[model samples]
Target: MSQATKRKHVVKEALGDFVTPTEKQQIVKVTGSRGNNLHEAVTARGVTFLVSMPPKFRKNLWIKRGDYVIVDPIDEGEKVKAEISFILYKDNIQYLQKQQLWPEGFTVEPDKEPEKAEETEKDEDFSGSDDDESDLFVNTNRCNYQYSESGEEDSQEEAS
Candidate 1:
């Protein structure tokens, strides 16, 4: 009888599972792609930056706008760009959420649409009567917010 030896295979672990992200890496939301291996993304802290895709990433990962990704900054200099390190997936997001490592304001709430509608309904159903509605509108126009140009004032007024 001939016996065959079993081979042990090395398995790679997913991000946030067996291994945690490095300090240099930051989670970012892909706002849009600028084409030519470049993309516009925003960090969890609301910092906007442009990220570049290297040949390896471009070939390996199928990235697109509105995808969450982990990036490592090129350097601590004037350049406001990073290298795409990991493309976030559903399982990765769930792992982050479970570990409480997910960034604030970036939580993927399952029932966001229903929650938003409930919040709107709650806002509309204020206990105070219509007579007290005017009191809720606080006007701070007297504050020192001078508009340099008349056009600026018009735009600001229109925005308010």
Candidate 2:
């Protein structure tokens, strides 16, 4: 059958009404023009339903980003088949339904500026000199100290 004569079945979950931090959301019914003839098969509240409406109905509802709608299978206008969602980021309805990411309500909180960790530096006290020969200074670029003995620490290795 042609696209206009075809009915699309979907299970959309409402993602509430509010701008979120840019994430994939629900699929909404795109009602065509006057007598556009759009059909849908839905399931809600443990019961299946079917709806037949014009594509213009969808646009009039402003099924834009982040809008919650319902499409009932049986007695559509008289029943609730599934949550209405805007079909976004996909060409066909089936591709959008596969996402299944829309949550019942707003589960995520508003964006908050991340706090930067504060850094404090306290002087280290190495007052007493206890020489452990094993103190091989692998990292010396970031350190400043004078060896009282006045001997290059790695002289032995150089001589060998």
Candidate 3:
């Protein structure tokens, strides 16, 4: 088959309905890429190992650190303990969690990031400041006054 056709098939498979892992398959979080098709991943049980990405997913789908993937164990290789079978998206992750198929060790901490950002923004409001002027210009030099809208320079001393 042509490369384009193969890529289409791969994308279709990835975007299709979420597939539950079989008995021998398990979900793992990618830790790092080891160049080529090899990736370092850690299982829910805290085991770290290498997994190989299938050729179809090489250019079609990109996997990165913190992404979850379903891996099928291999009986032959020592270093590459498994092969990546499926990549998991947020929707797929939610579906698996609802089904109670997700691993307990993998906490959904990413969802809390937005909340933390909101809290930081609230803290940066500077509502308690004593000065009536805006805090943004508090540290700027006051001598550099711009010309007024009438195109006339201000009375403040201009820098040489």
Candidate 4:
């Protein structure tokens, strides 16, 4: 049959609704295309649960990298078990993408950073003393003669 018709078969199992999804481990992956409700989930227990189309696909899309799905004690027609998985996700569309679990075929580039130059120790290069200030001088010319006139008031006193 055509793709649309083939999808209807995947939704409801040919064997009828006896699919038990309880503590059967979590659905590890979902594989199928859009407008196509038919998909299968490989559970942690290694058994694949043929998720009934449309309703189940809509509901079970939240089966992410880590989540628990419990099968209803009884089947509710094409929508056998309600996921409680809905409680895990805040939005519906996000739940779908997360459920796909195909980590490959996707690209993640490293974050860009501004490059920094490596630093090195610089040489100190200091001189011992300031030679420019030591070279300055002013002349003082009175060291050979002493002032000794009139220490006795109006009398000529000379060094004897």
Per-prediction backbone clash count? 0, 16, 0, 2
Error of 1 at 147 (Å): 69
Q: Return the lDDT, model 2, position 115.
A: 22
Best by lDDT: 3
Steric clash pairs (candidate 1): none
Models ranked on lDDT: 3, 1, 4, 2
Per-residue error (Å), model 4, residue 41: 0.4
What would the TM-scores of all predictions be? 0.55, 0.20, 0.72, 0.23
RMSD of model 1 against the true structure: 18.8
lDDT of 2 by residue, 34-124 (tens): 2333333322222333234435344333333232233323333553333333333223322333444443222231112122111111122
Tens digits of per-residue lDDT, candidate 4, 45-143, equal: 455444533353453233442233332222554433322221222232234336653223221211111121111111212332445655456347646
Error of 2 at 44 (Å): 7.7
Q: Which regions of candidate 4 fall more than 4 Å away from where they truly are?
A: 1-28, 33-36, 53-160
- After superposition, candidate 3 runs with Cα above 4 Å error: 111-160
- lDDT score, candidate 3: 0.89
Instruction: Give the top-scoring candidate (TM-score).
Output: 3
Q: Per-residue lDDT for 51-113 in model 3, tens only?
A: 999987999999999899999999999999999999999989989998999998786556677
Q: Least lDDT summed over 10 consecutive residues: which range in candidate 1? A: 2-11
Better of 2 and 3 by TM-score: 3
- Ranked by lDDT, the better of candidates 2 and 4 is 4
